[model samples]
Target: MPSTRRRPPRQRHPELERDFVRTPALGYEDVDGSGLVRCLAHGFPSPLVRWHFHDEYELHLITHTSGRAFVGDWIGPFEPGHLVLCGPRLPHNWISFDVPEAGAPERDLVILFNHDPIARAAEQIPEMREVLQLLDRARHGIEFFDMAEAARMHWEAVRGARGMRRFAAFCDLLCDLSECTDYRLLSAVQMQGVQAEAQVDQINEVVNRIMARVNEPLSLAGVAAELGMSESRFSRFFRRATGNSFTEFVSRVRINSACHLLMQTDCFIADICFQVGFSNLANFNRRFLEIKGMTPSEFRRQAESRFGAG
Candidate 1:
């Protein structure tokens, strides 16, 4: 039977499109390798998906953008001016694009540093050992305090300098971060569920493909075949990973996309239903209500009311 529920978020971009090169082994040599402190790049792009991870410590200073920020399996509605520190190999991505008319995309800086030296530095002191352990969990990702003018200043300082002076400034930035008390670590894999990150990534990849083919009928066997897994195994794995059956996941994604279109674009509701992968209106209306706690028309009315107020 066709789905009758709103779909949740799905992957975007689908590839790491870095403007600067900063690998762990080569460090920032790909960009400017004159100093020992290699690997620092900044970004401020419109919200899009392409979930991937790297072996580096990443500091993001989002100046004026907010949405459903997904760091690993940790998902939430983030406010503007968000700062996050993600450790190595922990799959993470932002779903801010899914929000209807998400705020500004203008950002200040994004800093990425190879993890080896930072790990080695924390290894020397027993007292700071926990902080190093924190870095390990960062492998799963960290969502730190918002705005944080000081953190933004630090990012600017590290990126604007060179030589040993730059390294010292980077250290200062970390010290300030370590002293911060109001921050939250992301990804359940960081604290528990050892395979959580991998599981989420697998589900996300599947979800991305689903998004790419939203208009067509999806079959369990077909999806499993695409991912090279047997139908039964895929079913179990997906359920355990997302706590939603495959049917529920797809429905949520389609309807959520429909809602985004309704609020952000001038598309008709009937058009949006199919555009987001649903086959018809009844299913879309039912699913939209399930996920959003309101009917589709009600959702549109409320959104219009809010928009008018703003």
Candidate 2:
């Protein structure tokens, strides 16, 4: 087989560029009954806490505990007082270190709102203009290294206040964050754009189901049938909503999970292949090579070299 392990040059075909753009999985949050901005607190290990994205911009504050934060392809340490802004369609998740004694406590305070609402407000109010640039930069995910106190105050205010007071506080919070200088972009690669919001909840539900049973023998036709959709209709809908065909998306997710297993466990390659739902070793190796650029053994060696053998 030809070597598929190399990263292609920047100047490839236009079609290849689109193929390289991997859209993050959609996350659907019900905020219709709430105000323009939705403020909520979540505990660690909750169902809401997962590797997913949405159509709204997220202002996330790490209130308690310390652990790893995954944004796009970047993985790094995060602690209490950590603050970040993830633009629409940026896949992110924070996995906290388990403290058996303390248990899983409420760890994050988050505010989510749409891009257009803030942009339109900026057009009408010149003082809000500064936040426009900040929002643009958030496409790669922004981590604020300073302004912990300001973030904490605004997070609490937005959660507690109602009516116009909450709206004003929310705007002020954006103004404060927009002026901050101590921040860095997290993701190396730019993400594919957002999809239709109306379809997001349904797509998220289907994606969540796929994630839950990734290690089992999953079939596209079966899932389509379960949703009471024809196979062709479901395939087209999934591609339009997620920017990837069902098979390609599932393989990517499976390979990503396999990478974690390779780094964290001592399981044999064949065992991992089976664990990730591949029927045979050869098929698993082939798919893994296409998505991950390296064979299973090579990936393990490289991962262990950088992170140390677990």
Candidate 3:
């Protein structure tokens, strides 16, 4: 497989790049009407499909086609009924491999909204506070399973309504997403709720250390000793807070870092293996394939499509 030798463009404005004649009706005016939410729809093979980020929380649904999905540091497959919520500035893109020569007429349904309005309101509205955790999880990107049909209905309702009705529909969607349990957090590391502030601080420090010195050996026993805890206690504490065993979390961090290098640099895969702290070529390849579902070279070749056709 070929590798990308440079970085992809980081931002794109589809509305300005293409005429709306081919896309589904857009709800851009709703941003002005409701002063918060904006809905968008686009077809496959359109300029809208690119690696990019913006300052809005986006709920994206795929109504047709199956292909690869790139969200922050996560790479995976997505098919019809795929739904994901990406937080502000989290880079993402979807490339449909099943598109016909004529291209798909309507493949994506999206809703974009700002964070400040709802966050500020939650400060005063007790009921509105429930969605805050959901929003926080969006920072890492959230893929909701079994939510496609309901998500489609909600998107249509919000798209067709105006004024308070539009806001109400949007809120109703957020409520269901907040209560959703069939979802996975994609990108970086997964963090569960930590009850104590001190514990949060401790875990944060440990994560920062791991990220900073990823090339170094970090053992659970060593970390436990540093924290003045026994091996089993530290293991339980770390797992409870991060949803991964200490060793697994370290491996994930290394793999995530390797993904970035594969996308941005032309370094040899063997060199990258050791650069990310893996002891040997065979182990690195195994771990990367296990986590990303592709070999390092295969990922690089596929990732180049994220920039879209120039």
Best by TM-score: 3
Per-residue lDDT of model 1, residues 1-310, tens digit only:
9998666533222235353534533223356453534444322343323355666666766655455554544445555567788776654554434333544334335676776665576678555454564565566566677437887788668767887888878778777777777776654321223276777678778777877887779888899998899999999887776567888877766765665565445566887788877876898888887776677666555443221121
| By lDDT: ranked, best first | 3, 2, 1
Q: How do the candidates rank by TM-score, highest first?
A: 3, 2, 1
Q: What are the runs in model 3 whose C-alpha is more than 4 Å off?
A: 1-27
Q: How well does each candidate superpose onto the true structure, as a TM-score?
A: 0.48, 0.53, 0.86
Worst ten-residue run, lDDT, model 1?
A: 301-310
In model 1, how large is the Cα lDDT of residue 226?
88
The residue ranges of model 2 lying beyond 4 angstroms of the native Cα positions read 1-33, 189-310
**How would you encode candidate 3's per-residue C-alpha lDDT over 1-310 as one tens digit per residue?**
8886665434332222222322334324323464577788888887667787787899999999999898887778899999999998888899898898999988999988889999999999999999999999999999999999999999999988988998899999999999999999988777888999999999999899899989898999998999899999999999999999999999999999998888767777888899999998999999999998889998878777666641
As for lDDT, the candidate ahead, 1 or 2, is 2
Separately for all candidates shown, the number of backbone clashes (residues 3 or more apart, or on different chains) is 14, 0, 0
lDDT-best of 1 and 3: 3
C-alpha-based local distance difference test score of model 3: 0.85
